[model samples]
Target: MLIGEVARHSGVSPRMLRHYDALGLVRPTGRTVGGYREYSAEDVRRIFHVESLRSLGLSLKQIGRALENPSFTPSALVGDLIRWTEDRLARERELLGRLRAIDASAPAGWQDVLRIVELMQGLNSASPARRLQTVLARPEGVSVPVGLLADAVLAESDPNVAGALRWALARSGGDGVAALAAGVHAEDVDIRRRAVLALAGMSEVPGVAAALADALGDPDPTVRGRAALALGRRGVTAAVPALVGMVVEGSSDVDAAEVLGTLSQDPGCAVRITTALVDELAAPAADSATRIRLTQALVELPVTSVLEVLRQLAHDDDPAVALVASAWVGVLDERSAEDRGDEDS
Candidate 1:
């Protein structure tokens, strides 16, 4: 077959066939009287082989080696090709994600498109300061796409940047609640923690309570703690056990105690919260420190509700716990006296 006939039958262009010949990748072995290049059957088969390797993302140089070198192994090269294709696919997916975010923003013009692109680039920047500045410097009233903020907040590692992103999400009127909710179940502990932290601030948003409720079972105590605290603030009774556990475990015990205190404002919830704490205190596993922490938490409850527990604790065997409980009993007595005196007046 001549070059044109080879091109016609094999779909390889004449110019590319000539280029392949010049590179010694697939040189035609025959020539006519007019001295035009002619390809033998084997040469045409080599051309197909080169095209096949190119389809697998092999460079021309690599293809030449693959075809010519007897020692060349396809296994390692195929593995490398798989990785390179994966990397290319990942880049394409990321670029597609950026485009979707930009499109989701519904930019009105080229300028808006530029601004959104710039914001995304800044959020992804290597410098934490740049990421922080990007979030902070967003022009007022230019609503960033909620999805963009959601993605940023989930992946952000720097404390300050994460806080800013959460604040921005909050100000977006809870638009990113679903994304943050999904992050609550993320495999990464840090992402789960960040998601709950962001959700904690958006309790007023619909579905946030449910998301936090789901987070109450998170294996990470920090995620569960934040979720419990958020739910406790919302007066969700389901948070009682976690909040009480927080107090007993000394994980954000102060904040947990404060929320428990707030939840105790309800007469029924007050009984439940107080009973849970007392149960933990009475558990055999309760150590001195645990007892002491539980005792301090009791101080946050209503004096009337916890007075009996404190009085009993005041006479407890542990001297440190007894001292703390004794002091709280006296403080409650004084407060009760002050109230009684005012009522009498």
Candidate 2:
């Protein structure tokens, strides 16, 4: 057929036919005596195949490869195509499941649900960490919807889940950290304590510091002590104020004393903070046993400032406080001299 006739029958424009001919994508089988282009039945079939492949998103190069070899199985090509489609559909189904869960929830307590939906959207767009971080930021005691919790639990099992969660947590805001911090108030003290410890290890959200600070006041001595230790582990200067308050308040409770001792050993803690703690322990109002425990903590740090703090404590009215402080000061002095010698060498 002539070019115009071929265009009409094939549903391709005349201009496109010419362009395909120029690119050698499609060519005439023969020419008339007057030089008019002629397309054979086989050429028409090839044109249909080309159009079909193009509609399926195959590039011209891919179509050429397929057509060049008639021995290539259509079933093989179609199987490959179906596999790609199925993979994409699976991901879409996961996203839809998350969305459906969110839509079914009431607004009054749907923050976690909404967050889950947002995370699913992120994953649909190939982001998973942003979702995990959102989960980590809820306030202590606030329970995320069961669905949202399940999503996080499932994410933990995914190989890529950790990387995404870490990235998102690193960039999380105060509100997000607060949510996770609130987990400290959960009725399940063990769960709450574990959550608090996890949050403390996270360097991403600054809000964890505030949460830890508040946890020190928990009615449960164990919770309060854990919070103090978490702050100390984090080593943020901001926590120094809270730690000092805990030391001076002198929890009569053994757990509280243990927590105070842990905070005293924090590497990030400054000399001045330790000194104030020592002074508090030496006060006439202070308990001699607590002073002894505080002295042990000062010994653990072994810094010059800590030694100085201990020296001040050596004058305590309690003979045991003075004796323990003096012993620790001698050990600290020896350690400091050795450290200086190493530096000099």
Which candidate leads the pack in TM-score? Answer: 1
lDDT of 1 by residue, 1-345 (tens): 899999999999999999999999999998999999999999999999999989989999999998889999899999999999999999998899899899989989999999999899999999999999999988887879999999999999999999999999998887799999999999999999999999998849998999999999998899999999989988898999999999889999999999999999999999988889899999999999999999999899999899999999999999999999999899999999999999999
Q: Pick the candidate with the highest lDDT.
A: 1
TM-score of each: 0.82, 0.41
TM-score of 2: 0.41
- Residue ranges of candidate 2 with Cα displaced over 4 Å: 1-147, 150-179, 182-195, 201-207, 244-271
Note the residue pairs that clash in candidate 1.
none
lDDT of 2 by residue, 67-147 (tens): 888787777777877898799899898768666657644445567666545645554344455544455555575433444
